[model samples]
Target: MSTGQTRSDRKPAPVKMVTTDTGRILRISPEDESARAAVAAAATPAPQNIDPARRTDVLFRVRRAEGHELSSWWMVGAFVVTSGLVIALLSWVPYSA
Candidate 1:
């Protein structure tokens, strides 16, 4: 009764428009064979239904260290000799000069 405006004449509320894809156009169809193959290949492989009795928890390696065994033996011998000499000197009481 105040302005005499009809319902059809009322303007719609403005919407805050936003594009998630950065306004770039892309053409893709589900019927494309390449897209289907890519989706399948990128998916994780399904778990196999194997017998639990045949399962193994052990892992084996055939690799060897690059260092020589001779060097290790030399290090052990040196440590033993040095320790023995230190013990002998500490155990010996000096006869005062």
Candidate 2:
């Protein structure tokens, strides 16, 4: 799944291809105004202005139980009850005469 901008979406920038002595080709973007602006925009961090009330609301919604959904405590209690019943049944069974 692509989450951000794709290469095909952006216009291809003019680049200089230089061959090194080690037979390696390097594609370098020109240090122009547009290139500098693009670099600056990419380097800039996104603003994060989170409201405490909004955060609490989101957290509450996440923790809120829906209909037919069992809580962790209920599941644990059921497991403990089933285990006790199994143990009691096994103890009552006579293995030897």
Candidate 3:
């Protein structure tokens, strides 16, 4: 019985076999290789003029947040609510002897 999927009579495209410098064989489609090359060329950024003297030695700095303090009241409340819910659910379940 057919699964309602139409089978194409067209043959599969031939793939090109390439040998890498590391003696590895790769089977790549011509269309895929060309498209990959095109993408790589497009993704390459142009070189920008950078000043050597103006370059900062520090890459990033980590600092503490000012006036942003966390309170433990919310954590305590959430814990109490979840514990009460678990106890309630356990009590609701019928105990089997």
Candidate 4:
């Protein structure tokens, strides 16, 4: 830190433009410009080292699907059995002459 210069003493830093070999102009911070330049040189990956044949197939188990279907059927069957029991209990009565 400089004793003579404080943050309050300085106006905002000016933007900088850099020209690359491809004729592209990029605006960036002067303080971080060197670090960014170093990164750009080594940032590219070797295409030959990457295998383009890689693929992914996501599959759900057929057994799990069937089990879920059976479970839903069982739930409906339970509801029917419960309703039948309730009806049978309500209809129960003793006949007296």
Question: What TM-score would each prediction reach against the true structure?
Answer: 0.24, 0.28, 0.32, 0.27
Candidate 4 has a TM-score of: 0.27
- Tens digits of per-residue lDDT for model 4 on 14-92? 8878765333577778787787779578566445543333312324423333445555778899999999998787777
Worst 10 residues of 2 by lDDT: 56-65
Off by over 4 Å in 4: 1-10, 39-97
* Candidate maximizing TM-score: 3
Candidate 2: C-alpha lDDT: 0.62
lDDT digits (tens) for residues 1-97 of candidate 3: 9999998999889887765433347677866888656654655453356333233543443333676545689889999999999888888789832
Query: lDDT winner among the candidates?
Result: 3
| Residue 12 miss distance in model 4 (angstroms) | 1.6
The full ranking of all candidates by lDDT, starting with the best, is 3, 4, 2, 1
List the lowest-lDDT window of 10 residues for candidate 3: 46-55
Give the residue spans of candidate 1 off by over 4 A. Answer: 1-70, 94-97
- Per-prediction CA RMSD (Å): 21.9, 19.3, 15.5, 17.2
Error of 2 at 56 (Å): 36
Candidates sorted by TM-score, best first: 3, 2, 4, 1
The digit string of per-residue lDDT tens for model 1 on 5-94 reads 656966655433322222324344544547646755666653467433333542442334466235588889999999999888877867
Candidate 4: count the clashes: 0
